[model samples]
Target: MDFDVDDAATLMALLDEKRPRRVTQSLLSGWDMLQTDLPSRERIESATAVLVGTGLATVDEDWGMLLTAEGARIRRAVPGRGLGMRQIPGILGAQLRARGVARADLTLPAALYDAAYSAYMEAAAHREERAYRRHWWETWKPRRQR
Candidate 1:
């Protein structure tokens, strides 16, 4: 019944699976700019492991990360339900019953989940802090202000 926000956030990210759009990335330079910033490699790996363990996602060495069918359905339904992240267990437990799955088969450890969220945020902040655009106009824009 009790759940941490950090844990829920991490679980949400696990549920929100993604894969590279190689064609789009190849065709458009701006694709990188529009993409969600990647979490640290360590964070991503750890999360991927957890996702795979939980049967929420699968990673293909060639294709990157993807949601399992169940994961995708849960992602679409649960995230937009307007429930607080802390209600993750409640919803997930409901899902188990609906799917005729054994609750004992799933592990929802708070410490493990919390670590993923914290690691991702830390990495993103470290990566973005003091960063600036590389375009020619970007170089001049700061000088123009001074």
Candidate 2:
């Protein structure tokens, strides 16, 4: 499957949120960081299929699309694993201080950190881009001008 960064991010976020087990609907609902636009049911299903096919995620008769062992490993390797939302900014600040570079300046070796970082950044950027677009449309742009 030719899944893009955003798709991988969505899968990973879903796996993180609904760890251990999750059905399709639950995965969709729990994807707060990545599903603001809310893809059609067809798209969600297709993405799930791709994730499973790639072995980044797994599905059972009961659990729709839970993380595989590989997936868990990837999650744990993320720069700020086990941190809650409230702690992310602080953790990122600490990382930046320790590294002597901006968080955005850091890049992981492709062999080691590529998959997890790719997925995380994809989801994060997707949300940021969506929010920017929404603000531009709803607040920045004048409706009368349009």
Candidate 3:
């Protein structure tokens, strides 16, 4: 599933160090806390829908919404978009700048870890790698078995 900037922003709001959160309570507040530029409520809701459809988020009536294990894993793996030496300072500056004026996409944060990540994922899909890992886990012993 393709995740656009809106989807990214929505996911950011939902993620609270792996804690469950009420959607209505967390959505706008997270953006404000992070000094993110305001996106329309509809936009945020739409993004949430996409995330749910992709199995990245689960909504519980009692506990609100939470990121699934896969969601959190993907989030952790997501690399910043433009985290170059010169860009680092600018990204920081933007975060501390005025909220609405701040461009949410600045520093191009997290367009998903595509380059090396894609290659790694592709390689991991091979059965040979899985077999090797399984064999190492099942057969390898640090000391001689008695």
Candidate 4:
């Protein structure tokens, strides 16, 4: 969802309510708060573009793209915040299963620890690769000038 600063701010405000909100209502409320003309369908579409670009929201096949985990975390960390705790264990369990974290293996405490450690190491390696790429770009550009 692409949104500008105004729209982003509005979404953040509504998220503070910690209640499930419809996309349409949220858009309307945002416009109301801004004291601007009501948003047309086209305007809403444009705002969605901004929101998605900024990584503030995402869409899922099951649940139309709402705020992402990072967006939720930001909402929670805000002062005087009241973010909802959506259980979503099904989502986490599904991700684990997709990553081959067997449910039966979890029953064995020792195996569960080992599986988790392996997954953590895999993620750390990917992160390190990204960091290396970023560092290389930052360093190589300057050296090439000489």
User: Best lDDT goes to which candidate?
Assistant: 2
Residue-wise C-alpha lDDT for candidate 2, range 94-143, written one tens digit per residue: 33234331111122133322343345557768879999998788886677
- TM-scores, in order shown? 0.37, 0.44, 0.42, 0.38
Clashes of 1: 0
- How does candidate 1 fare on TM-score? 0.37
lDDT by residue (tens digit), candidate 4, 1-146: 22234444444444422344444444354444454445444444444454455565553332234666655665554444343222232232233233331111001133433444455556657979999998888888876674
Worst 10 residues of 1 by lDDT: 22-31
lDDT of 3 by residue, 1-146 (tens): 23233444444434643677643333444543354444444454455555465555665544255776765665545445744323332332232232221122112112222332344435546757889898887777656661
User: How much lDDT does each candidate structure score?
Assistant: 0.44, 0.49, 0.45, 0.44
Off by over 4 Å in 1: 1-38, 79-146
When sorted by TM-score, best at the front, the candidate numbers are 2, 3, 4, 1
Whole-structure CA lDDT of model 4: 0.44
Cα lDDT for residue 47, model 3? 50
Model 2 segments more than 4 A misplaced: 1-5, 16-20, 24-26, 81-146
Evaluate residue 112 in candidate 3 and report its C-alpha lDDT on the 0 to 100 scale: 22
The residue-level lDDT of candidate 2 at 32 comes to: 43
lDDT of 4 at 7: 43
- Steric clash pairs (candidate 3): none
Error of 1 at 94 (Å): 12
